[model samples]
Target: MPLKQPIGQKRLTNVAIVKYKKKGNWFETACYKNKVVDWRNGTETDLDEVLQTTAVFKNVSKGVLAKEKDLVDAFGTNDERAICTEILTRGDLQVSEKERKLEYENLFKGVATVLSEKCVDPNTNRPYTITMIERALKDVHFNVDPKKSAKVQAFGEALPLLQERFSIQRANMRLRLKLAAACKDEIQSRLAEHKVIVESKEADGATVAIVCQADPGLYQVLLALVRDLGKGHGHLEVVSLAVQREGMSGEGQASGDIQGILKEQQRASELSQVPYVTSQPASTTGRLRARSEEDSMAEVSYPRGPISGIPDDVTRKPMFLEIDGLQPGWEVELTKRGESGVVDAVFFSPSGEKVGAFVQARRAALSASKKAAAAQSTVE
Candidate 1:
């Protein structure tokens, strides 16, 4: 499991080693106790005494020392110290499975802690506990790469999966800002990085008005700016807020998630509302049985690949949807929450002789889209 621990020798404890390949020959170096030190920077005592061994080896785990001739040929020196320095500084460090597992676990929790502190429930505007974030991650079977930083991966890589199931959002505090005209330039400079919308030019000549979505910490800075610069002329109004996904419509508004999508005769229609659904989630365990061997579920666009992009790890609850035209035992199921909002519709047949399925979009989202377009046109 751990790169075949070279045969019968037990490697030394507290002595870290680097495995290097030079001119098709493998060499390993022994560094100071439990650390892979830079050979260029260590003091003379660290090289002479603390380093467990000066003899470079072909395999530390096997007790096989590198030959002098091979070392000279590969490194242009028979000197073990010089060769060891190059190998130690330039080579890859090998880690045991136990060590690797520990590092992996630490990094996984680090990512979770980062998310717990920086993100908030979009509904409640409160941070999720670390336990809750960790559970959601386990449900998604998230993999953490030891090479990447926990903070670096938290938003771009980890959060997307959690968002599909949880209500987590990177915290953004929506604040309504009003200040004396004299403080305008400084306030703008301070909040330039945040999502600041110039709400309106106020009727009073001496006042400036704006709406800014800022980090919770940034509120203190706003308070200070207004107190120090505006001379008690203005105040801050706080509103419920959460960070919106990039490229979504409006300043902080989210275009509604696709509740369901139906394709009838090669046409794709977006469904906004599920008029009727049972309290439980659908049981999507095995393959859906189709009407005929000649006609497969793949023929239709409703369910996406691998039984419709629904990963097996998601916590699924069974839900029942009713279709009017289906025969006595036949049924159509509409599932929600995974990948693209919904897993689309999977219709089952009772008799398998004459199987037909048709789905229609709920009109609320369609009507809203049209109304928004009309309002924008009128404004223009």
Candidate 2:
């Protein structure tokens, strides 16, 4: 049997017949190389020799092989086809095992270099050397496809290994909060749920001041919850502390002085107050002076209009109005001639509870208009 073709080798056979005239008969032989028949001169020459005289011929060797039919289809002239075949038949296209190994090594080195620059050791806060990265890579087993580019192999396969081996540290944080009396219970419950270290809690009148420390990752979530609970009324301050180096702890150190912080908090609270005069009332109208000396001399008139059939009482202070729809039984103190007078009218139920203001006014006006129309109809 004929010898089997080697693996990855293309099958090539001298199947074309070439005939030449001898002394008395014609002789035939299988053609291994391409040939051309010059009918005009009856001459035969190798295709390579024929192409050397043409401008299409170059001194470069072929890197990949092409079949005879394919070469003919690719080029318009025989000389061009022969030149392409020669260059393709050369062995420059195939990469050796050693070269492929070297390329992969270069790719791995590039990946290590990138990680060294971009990533740092979490314990020391310093970048890892290339040798350290290479050592880490040795512990992990992975395959790199030679077909992919170096950048793809580095990021897709190598980067994840480096990141998994070396992780970043969570940051430490300090938080100070000035909690409002109304939301103190809710805020404390949330803080306890998060398990933050509450260093101190001091009561300054109705408000509670608290200082705590926690990990940044968990603190961020807790901070959002606190802000939601505060609803623009609470005050919070966050400070970032320097990262602790390896083998160091802040446990034994004395706590820093917080007296200055408390003093500042007191000053801020003082500034936020609205000052009012403490002088006696002018005529029992229950209107206190605005503390403006120039305006104090001018007589401030109070409105005498009744509210929802409840006549204004100049002697007695207006009762705090308990409204149903306003925050579900929340009470708002109303005065006869102050902010409450801005509305058209106020409404109260038979049980002496405030209902609504503007809505009741609209209903009363419509009812009175309807009564007038009915009376006119009866007279007609």
226 Cα displacement, candidate 1 (Å) = 17
Candidate 2 per-residue lDDT, tens place, 286-307, comes to 1112212212243323332233
Best by TM-score: 1
What's the count of clashing pairs in each model shown? 7, 3
Candidate 2 to truth, TM:
0.25
lDDT of 1 by residue, 214-327 (tens): 766577877777677677777888864444321111111122221210011011101112121212211111101111211222233334222223344432212122222212
- Judged by lDDT against the true structure, how good is candidate 1? 0.54
